[model samples]
Target: MLEHELVFALREIALLGGILGDVELSSSELGGILGISQQTASRRILELEEAGYIQRKPGVKKQLIHVTESGSERIKAEKEKYERIFEMGSRMRFSGTVISGMGEGRYYISQPGYTLHFRSALGFEPYPGTFNMQLNGAELNKLNILRNREGYTIPEFSTGDRTFGSVRFFRAEISGEPCGVVLPLRGHHKGVLEVIAGENMRQKLNLRDGDEARLTVFLDR
Candidate 1:
């Protein structure tokens, strides 16, 4: 859905208890609340229902409306955007335990297509591998919030009949060492983060499996 529609119409419905439970209101009443005409309010409701953001059951006088799970997720995404806007210029810290990866990071990061862009955009040649981390619930939520913000983009490239997907990365520091938090545009794993640095982070930092590491991500206004 469009941003304005989500911000005004859907937000108004969610504020009217649609997110928690069913909300019964007629188009006229919704229009009065939104300061729009009854026809416009009804169209907005239809648009939301068609987009799978809401479920509506028509009644004689009012309609029983409930926000779907997808709708709740959209609202959460919008909330994250606002949070990032207000928290700009602040450093976001995430703590996680070092973990083992499936060796995919080694293969992908070693590719010349990705390595060239990583070096140019991140200002460092990656160590041909990644430092994997397993994040907790709170840290995962913070990561999700960062995902919604704009970050450095590595465009997709083709190499020898194979196509590599794009990536998004945010500049970060671990123990005051410059690094990046890499997020694959495709095949992303939940609750897991892959970090890239110029050198082997484990050796440089003397880290081991299950060691707690803190990353400080800089945010711009």
Candidate 2:
């Protein structure tokens, strides 16, 4: 797969074509599977062919299409990506300086809408407050990628007159102790990371403002 999800999708289509004995496929069939219009499907196929990721069998009455070696390499690249992700899950690392938050985490986390999902998904009751950290330049970039990563999602729901937005959680270890990273679908700051655990992290970890802390985030939980 390429860096973009759309490109990966094209590669996946080609791989499927290769699997069915390089059989001919109609635009309608491809469009149906992709939930796209037949015209769009035809355009995608043309683009894939131009990129050398797929080819139409010459002189074939049925218009057979197959994945090229280049396309197979793209799938191989996707495999390598997952491999790296798993490897990172085992021991992925990130670090930042402990910082201060708006002091609202305690209120939001204490609510049932957030707490129930936290316990169900992360397997622990988060402490009343969240430990805030400021990521360095490189770590901030990593956090951006981690934001869209697969994890547990706490859906948005209404409580009383207000509705709360959904949030995502990833199992992690802060300074080698089990914890989690919480990210709201809408966030206030880009460089900040908020952590949750069963205990007050600042006290348990003996952390203070300006102290540098590292966390090992597990992608698969």
Best by TM-score: 2
Could you give me the TM-score of model 2 versus the true structure?
0.59
RMSD, every candidate, angstroms: 13.9, 13.4
Task: Give me the candidate number with maximum lDDT.
Answer: 1
lDDT, candidate 1, at 59: 65
Mind giving the per-residue lDDT tens digits that candidate 1 earns over 1-221? 46576457778889999999899988898899889889988888998888888999976768999899998888888888688656555668788999988888999999897788778767878998899889997668887777777777788888887898888778788999988888887776578889989999999999999999988777542
lDDT of 2 by residue, 67-96 (tens): 778877877777776786668745466789
Provide the overall lDDT of each model, using Cα atoms, as 2-decimal numbers. 0.83, 0.78
Model 2 scores worst on lDDT over the 10 consecutive residues at 1-10
What's each prediction's TM-score?
0.57, 0.59
